[model samples]
Target chain A: MTTLLTDPATTGAHRADTTHPSVSPADAVRQTMTMAWRATLKMRRNGEQFFDVTIQPILFTAMFAFIFGGAIAGDVGSYLPLMIPGILAQTTLTACMATGVQLREDMDKGVFDRFKSLPIARIAPLAGPMVADLLRYGIAATLTFLMGLLMGYRPGGGVLGVIAGAVLAMIAGWSLAWVFAWVGTIGRSAQGVQGISMMIMFPLTFLSNAFVPVETLPGWLAAFVQVNPVSHVVSAIRDLANTGTLTAEVGWALAACAIVVAIFAPLSVAAFRRRM
Target chain B: MYAVTTSPTPPTTSAVRTEGLVKAFGGRRAVDGIDLEVFPGEIFGVLGPNGAGKTTVLRMLATLLAIDEGRAEIFGVDVRERPHVVRQLIGLTGQYASVDENLTATENLVLFGRLQGLRRADARGTAARLLDRFGLGDAASRPISQFSGGMRRRLDLAASLITRPPLIFLDEPTTGLDPRTRGQMWDTIRELVDDGATVLLTTQYLDEADQLADRIAVIDAGRKVAEGTPDELKSSVGDSSLHLLLADPTQLAAAAETVRRQLGGEPVLTPERGRITVPLERADRAADVLTALRTAGISLSSMSVQKPSLDEVFLALTGHDTHSETQETAA
Candidate 1:
């Protein structure tokens, strides 16, 4: 040990050579994928993280279909078409809330400090877990449709249309997740992010046409629901799942998603950079 | 004490160099203008109390925080302009254990290795080797939440070495560990330096700096107050003193006079107890003073050499106890 300390050549041999090239764009993508894998492993190890997407979808889909079916649509079968798409949109959006809550939790625990010191891309930590969350959204969407099928609702759009509807809902969920990610970066604690996300989510999902037709809402309440982006998403899913047709509503929903990513992606990255 | 001065040109072998580096929060400077230089394969210790800007300066050098003023360079790369490049040349184990508690020990190390640009198979291989080296092989698959503080700290240190960067920053690496664990951490640091990695370590424990640092800079209130080798700093406090407690209280005055004559200085006499202290001009003079006291018929109950402690050095330099202030400034 004494000789090792005194001999500069032997000791310096372990020093990393700085002449190696800088990280390439391809390496950034790989690092992001590694982070995504970590997020997926965490979700798998902790079964509780799955409760929202799995059990909540089954329980809410049945509860909403049974309690409101008769009064709103005359029968459970008739309401499934409307209710399935609504529940799908609602559950997927709720699942995205976890992205912000978990991000805040991870940040508070100081893991990001290590990430900031690494040569990886700045967006890897922010975007990687979000990529993994696409799976959670998919699970919730699938369960909601499965529950709809068990309630005697048959879709005229068939399997392909149902698959399309699920895909569109997941894309919307992914895009909306950026908003929560931004909140995660700015929030002080995980609980704070959870509270703020819940407050925003309840109003966005409940006030929209997810539960009932906007026409049935009171005039003053309908005004807000008409402009809610969630309502357009639900309408787009319904058009694809119930009628097997892609309409202007789908285009509107996609445009809303694109706009959200455009605005919040840069904002989330900026806020994250400032804090680090 | 070395005066604080800016170097016109840092040496080519320097692993790290900083000039007038400053970081402020809410209009108050957390790190006042500071200058430092650390050479390759050297263990440079930044000794200061909590909130003395030790961690803040390290953070800027590691590219974890933006430098508000002046310049910081790592291996000749400007940290602010090319942080990614700087990052590639260094690894940091922060003041806190920054590993993911939700992930197992192996998982955490592998994740770090992968992020450091190791191939998948190579990452796994490195994780296994590090786990074994750190004596954490048996608990490799267990989540960090179940590990003790020492285990978590070891894992944290292991994660930083995944890339074996030429320079490493350790921020209070043993702040909350038991004495035995701190000893282990010291050995690990020594091994890292022996392997040719230049280390810049910030610590509040004076003994830690004395044991590990090749050179130490004593900082207080965001400014460096002293910089020197440990022995140099100790000697600056003057030669060791010879303290004597006489068995016969009536012989105190005689013993004081005898010590003064032998040491050629005024001896401090305590009246409450028969105690006399005299500075020894040289350590060999201790034998002469003891024999002179015995010949004078002043029997002694206890007599020992009291070398100046780092605590006294810190007190003399900063005018405050080392552990008095607990509140730290934001970085």
Candidate 2:
């Protein structure tokens, strides 16, 4: 054993003088893409990851169209327009919660320990998964709209408008995911992150105008819903999908998304660095 | 091939140095205060029971945990002030495998290589070569979830070696592996040193330190209690001893007297087991004592020369068994 280990050819030949180069902006982007690619491969292999964006959107859209369509909007036909945008907003936002849950799971499993020791940019691991999750949001948004179309709902906004609505929803989801990513860094476990995220998301999506028109809700409850950022997102998607026109709500939603990214991106990175 | 560069640079002389290093969780100090100097091209073993702060010290050095107090430097790079540079000099394998179970072995290696700044094609080529070198070529495409404990560990070690960093930290690398696999890991570590890398290895197993470490530090309660070579440690405990169990209980006194006359030392006798034990000045003296006992018409059940076990050395230094303490901390 000693003779084998002492063989210089087997050992010294592999030794390369590794230089520590300062991480540039371009390197950071490449490293983030590497991590994002890993996340994408994981999502592909894990069938459960697709269950949310695929089955949940299809099921929720059908359940809302059949169960609450006539009672809320007088028929399924009119409800498709209302429910499609609402479900798109809800499904995409809900999908963001998985980002935190998976991050926490990765941390608990000690995967971040390897990343923490690496010389790459600190933000790559946190930001990479969020970038990959844009695909989940895209799937949820597209499926919700397709389910709406299957139910005979037509958007006057044309194909371009519906596509615009899906893109907007996906962007909103990506921004919201940063909040969950922050929670993931500080949370004790995946289950804990999921619990906390669900508590925050349930009220944000359910109580907003995503489900019902604000006027029909009680005045006090309706007031809170109108101010909810999720309501702005739902209203923006409704405008884009229903009328195919850019509206003021889209500006408010974009501002909200920008504000979220600006605040939580640094917060998440800070929390991540502290933990390391 | 890289020749053995004998640069007398100060940084190359010491791969790791820590002074008064301390880490605490809440109000409890996990690593009270540690002082370590691991020179280049040598394997330094930190031997301790679980929760004795071995992992804590390694984690701090690896820059995975912040140093609450004191200082740590890796090849002259301050771990706290310039962590990125320290990271470039070191590779760390945590107590856990730390590899992604969801990803295949190839993917995990490629991902680490890319993160370390290798181009995509270079990363893939490195991954393939490492997989082959580590004997994982056939299982390279399989997800780590399907791997056995030993395979996962090999992959984890291979992942850390992707960049061939000058310094490596392995925290209980063979803690959960079987003996055969642990032997393989020890060889791998020795091979690393042969390639001109310095290693700081933390282990709870005493034989592991004796087998691999050029020097060992025995730590308990987050402090170093003893530091020496394995031979120095064993000799410090006591001289080697000869132990004999008599086949006939009635001949115990006769056998003790013969051992005393021949070996010039009194034999401690245990009446219940009909056993006699005598410390020897030289290990070869055991043969002379055995012949004298037989000449006295004493029949023995068994006789053997025994050196002090690490458990005895640990007991002499810390007044407790390391194995039990490890179990307590694990519990």
**For this target, which candidate reaches the highest DockQ against the unseen true structure?**
1
Flag regions of model 1 displaced more than 4 Å: A1-23, A217-227, B1-13, B240-266, B274-276, B280-307, B323-326
Give one digit per residue, the lDDT tens place, for model 1 in A1-276. Answer: 001113334323222232233556777788889999999999988998889999988999889988999999998888899889999989988898999999888877667889999878888898899989999999998988888888787988899889989999999999999989999999988999999999989998999999898889999999999878888899999999998899999999999899999998889889888887
RMSD of 1: 5.5
Classified by CAPRI criteria, candidate 1 counts as acceptable
Q: Per-residue CA lDDT of candidate 1, range B203-298, in tens?
A: 887678889999999887788889888777767766788888989888888888888888898888887898888887677898988899889887
lDDT to native, each model = 0.85, 0.85
- Range of the 10 consecutive residues with the lowest summed lDDT in candidate 1 chain B: B1-10
Number of colliding residue pairs in each model: 1, 1
Alpha carbon lDDT at B108, candidate 1? 95
What C-alpha lDDT, on a 0 to 100 scale, does residue A152 get in candidate 1? Answer: 88
For each candidate, the DockQ is 0.40, 0.38
Candidate 1, residue A107: CA error in Å? 0.7
Instruction: Report the CAPRI category for model 2.
Output: acceptable
| Residue A98 local lDDT, model 1 | 93
lDDT of 2 by residue, B96-124 (tens): 88899899999999999988778778889
